[model samples]
Target: MMTHTETRSAVLSIGRVYCDLIFTGLDHLPVLGRELFASGMEIAAGGGAFIAAAHMAHAGRKVALAARIGMDSLSAGVEAQLRESGVDLRFVEHAGDAGPQITVAAVVGQDRAFLTRRAGPALPATLDAALDWEEACHLHIAEYATLHEIPDLVSRAKEKGLTVSLDPSWDATLIYDRGLLRACEGVDLFLPNLEEAEAITGSADPQVAIRKLSLAFPLVVLKGGAEGAWVMSSGRMLHAPAETVPVIDTTGAGDAFNAGFINAWLNGASEEMCLRAGIRFGSLAVQAAGGARLLTTAE
Candidate 1:
C-alpha cells in the first residue's frame, strides 16, 4: 500500500460520496413507458471527489477524501470498492441522511445519461478538519453544486494557504446561474467539460468558449473528450489531442482527467504536459466500465 502522512503533497478532495449503479452497452435509452436492457452492469464507488481522489491515489499521490457517505444498504454495496481505492477515508463521514446518494448511469454508444438522488446536504461536516489538515497543500472541489452549497469554500481554503481547483460538474439548475463565475472567484484552477464550458460561456465553439473562460480564471483547462483538451494560462493557450482507446463507459472520465491534470500541475509540469496527462487518464477511464475500475488493477 502507498504510504500517507509522511507525504506533504496531500490533496483534499471535497464532495459527496455516491454508490454508482452503472449500465452499459444498451440498445437505446429508456423513454416513457419503455423498457431497456443493458449488456453489462457494475456497482462501484463514485462521486467526483472520490473518483478523482482514487485516480490520484492510484498515481501515487497521497489523497484524502472529504465527503459524506450514507449508512444505508445501498452505501454498503460500495464499501469494499471504496476501501480498495487507496484513498484516505479519515475525513469521510458516515451519516444516515448523507446517502442513499446514488447515481444510475446508463450509456449507449459514446453518450451517457445519469439519474441521481442527492441526499441530505452538499457540504460535509468535516470541512473544518479537512481545511486544517497539516499535510494538505491543495483543495479539489468536485462539483459546482458543492461550491453553490458553500459559496465561501474557495476563500476558506485560500485563507489556510491552500491552492484550490474547481470542477463545474454539470448540475442542470446551477449551470445557468449568472453568478456562477462570481461564486468561483478565488479558485486557482478551473476544469470544465465541453458542455459545461459552452453553457458557461454561451459559445458552442470550443475556441471561443475557452477564451471566455480563461478571462475569469488564471488557469482554465477544458476537457473536450475525443477532441482532447485545451488549456489557457497567462494569455497563452495550448491544446492536446485525445489518446486513442476503446470506449467501454464514459462515466466519470472527466473526473479522472482532473486527477491526471492536477497531479501534473502540482508537480509544476508545463501546461502542455498537464493536458497530455489528462488525456492519458481520460483515455484509460473509457476503457473500463467505471471511472476508477482500471486504476484498481493498473500498474
Candidate 2:
C-alpha cells in the first residue's frame, strides 16, 4: 500500500466547508408539506474538500485543508472532527459572527438530497496567503465555483511546481456556461461525474463528454456511480468496475474516490491501479453512516 513517506507529497485541498447533518435509513424522500421519519441521524464534518482531505489522511497521506469556517459553537465541533481525522488545519481561516455552514442531507438507500445554507463568502482573503505551496506536491480543488472565484488558481499552482486536479462538483449555474470549459484549461486532471460531464458538454453520452473534456485537460476521470468509472489519459481509454458494498449514504463517495486515486497517482501507480484504488475507497465510504466516517479507520 502507498504511504505518506513513499510519496513524500502532501495534498492541499481547497474549497468550502460545512457541518453535514445526515439523516439515514429513510424509506424515501419526503414529499412537499410532509414529514418523514428516519431511522438514524448524525452530524459530521463535511464538504467535498473535507471529505477528500480526510480520506487522504486516513490513507496515510500528508493532507492539508484550506477553507473558511465560522468561529461559532457549531463550527467548534466540526473543526475538532477534521483535526481528529488527521487533516492539517493550519490553512483553515476563521469567519467571525457568521455561524457554521450547515447542510441537511436526507439519505434514502444509495441516494441523497441536500439543502445548504452557507455562512459567509466561500473564500477568505487569507486563503492564498495561508497556502504553503512549497509543502504541496498536488493541489486538489473541490468545486468549479471555487476555481471561478480564483481564476488564476491552476496557473498559480503550476508556477509553484505543483500539479493540480479539480472535481467540478455540480454547479447548477456554471454547468451550462461555456466559460466552465475555459476554466478547466491548464488543469492536469479533471474529475466530473457522468451527469455533471453531460451537463457541462451538452452531450447526452458519457463517451462524447469524456472526449470533449480530454481535449481540454491532459487527464479526464469520469465518475459513474454504479457503473464504475472511466479514465481517459494520453488518448487511451480505461475502465474500472465498482466494488459491491452495502449502501448507507452516498454523501462523500466521490470525494473518497478522488483521495484514493490521487494517493495512488502520487505513488507512481498505473492508471488501472489508481482506478481500482478509487473504487475501493468509494466502496468503504458508502458502507458507513457519515461522509468520511469509514475513512477514519481505513487502511
Candidate 3:
C-alpha cells in the first residue's frame, strides 16, 4: 500500500472493483451450450473506477480508488496489480468472502461479453469517506449503480468544493429510469458511450441524445469507439477522431477515455484537447488484452 499524501489536484474515483479474467483472439462468440477457445488469456484488476484511476496515475496524476473487495487470494492479486499501477488504494476496503469477479470473452474487432458475480452490496460508505478526504480535487463516479446507491453523492461532492464527473457505464435496468437525469444534477461532466446515450435519452441520433443530456450536465462527452468521440459543452460541439490501432480487446477503453479527459480537464485544458487526450488513451488501451495491464506497463 502506498502512503497517502495531501495533493491539491488528486482525483477520487468510486465504483465497483473486479478481478477480470480476459480471454482474447476469439473469432466469434460462443453459441448456447457450445464451447469456444481463445488464443490468449490475461488476468488483471478491472472495473471502471480502477481502470480510470490507473490511467490517471499513469498520466502522472494523483488518483485514489475507493471500492470494496474481498479478502480472498483473487482480490489480493487484484490489489497488487493496482498498487503496481501507482494508484493510491488507501480508500479501498475489504469485505466478507471473495470480491466481485468477471470473466470477459473478447472477440477480435467485435464486442465482448461478461459473466460477473458480486459478493456484496455497493460501497456507499467507502465513497463517503473518500469524498471527505481533502486531497481529492475531483470526484469521478465510475458507474451509475454507485450513484444510484448513493443518491446524494453528487451534491455531497459539490458541497465539499470538488468538481465531479460521471461515466454511466452501461446498466440495463437503470438506463431506462426517468430519474437518471435528476440523479446527475450537480455533476460537471457526464460521459457515456453511444449505446448508453441513446438508451438514456431514447434518441437514435447521437446529436439529439447529446443535446438532451447536455441540458442536464454542463459538459457531455459521447464516446464512439473506432469512429471517435464527441464533446458538447456550453453551446458548441467538438469532435476528436479516433486514432487507428490494431485493437486486441476493448474491455476498459471507455474507462481509459474518462481518465484522459478528466486528467486534461483537471489541468485546465481546452475541450478539444481533452477530447483528443481521451481518444489517445482509449486507442492505446485497446491495443492490449486487458485494460489495466497495458496502462500499468506504460507507467
Candidate 1 segments exceeding 4 Å error: 1-7, 296-299
lDDT of 2 by residue, 1-299 (tens): 23334343888999888899999989899899998999999999998999999999989888888898888888998988987898988888887844678989999878899898777666756666545445678889999988888888888777776788999998787877888878778888888999899988888687888988999988899999999998998889899889888888899899999988988888888889999988888889998877788644465
- Number of the top candidate by TM-score? 1
For candidate 2, the per-residue lDDT at 56 reads 90
Model 3: per-residue Cα lDDT over 153-174, one tens digit each: 8898989888889999887879
Error of 1 at 214 (Å): 1.0
lDDT-better candidate, 1 vs 2? 1
**Span of ten consecutive residues with least summed lDDT in model 1:** 1-10
Backbone clashes under 3 angstroms, per model: 0, 0, 0
Question: What's the lDDT for all of these models?
Answer: 0.88, 0.85, 0.84
Per-prediction TM-score, please? 0.96, 0.94, 0.94
Clashing residue pairs in candidate 2, if any? none
